[model samples]
Target: MSKPIRNSTEMTDITRLEQANAMMRLVNQALARNDLAALAALGFCHPHIGELKQQGGFRSSSIAQNTRMITRLRKVGDTHAQ
Candidate 1:
């Protein structure tokens, strides 16, 4: 069997996982709100989800994994037309 991970390494992994989780939450909320600007900002500077897919499952499911942000802006006329 493989040896257990070091405590510090375990903590670092935990922190990375938490950060990825938080980024996912923010990305989902932005998507739900249709706030493309916020999503774009995150997309540009978002933390690197761990290289391991399992380590960053949240990013795998959210738009944060996207390399670019593409969304149509709501025009004033369109809003008034509704």
Candidate 2:
């Protein structure tokens, strides 16, 4: 059997990451594209991010990665467009 989580923060992190990974898979399928930037630009992202925030979590720890994720998800057809 798995050991119990050490504390709340640890539990939250575990739960959040697990959720993020699962969500990412579904998001990938929904997007029907592997382009990371594309996924970051739509309403789908809000639901994903909002759910994580509600869980008291972040998209990821790396600021660069978060920016990239957001940039990719933008609604513009051109992934690189500002």
Candidate 3:
């Protein structure tokens, strides 16, 4: 059997997955409403949004990239909270 992930790593992975899932839901809502402004705020370019529209969903790469942004922004907030 494969080795299990350590607790810290598993928690990080779970957090990232949750962030990605949340981002996916927001993107879908924005897409359904044709909310370009909201999508743009999430770092999606016009061309990229067009492609996402055609695909009917954002790619994993896009989700991960945006999720990383969220993580970075959270870190900044945490630093301020200290």
Measured by lDDT, the strongest candidate is 3
**Per-residue alpha-carbon lDDT of candidate 1 for residues 2-79, written as tens digits (9 for 90 to 100):** 444335544455556567667777766666675667866886333332222224334454543331211111232234
Regions of candidate 2 where Cα sits further than 4 Å from its true position: 1-5, 33-82
* Overall lDDT per candidate, in order of appearance: 0.48, 0.47, 0.76
Candidate No. with top TM-score:
3
Error of 1 at 17 (Å): 0.5
Colliding residue pairs in candidate 2: 37-72, 40-73, 41-73, 41-74
Q: Name the weakest run of 10 consecutive residues (lDDT summed) in model 1.
A: 67-76
**Candidate 1 Cα lDDT to native:** 0.48
Positional deviation of 78 in candidate 3, in angstroms?
A: 27
Q: Candidate 1: where are CA atoms >4 Å away?
A: 1-6, 44-82
| Deviation from native of the Cα of residue 31 in model 3, angstroms | 0.2
Better of 2 and 3 by TM-score: 3
Clashing pairs in 1: none
Clashes of each: 0, 4, 0
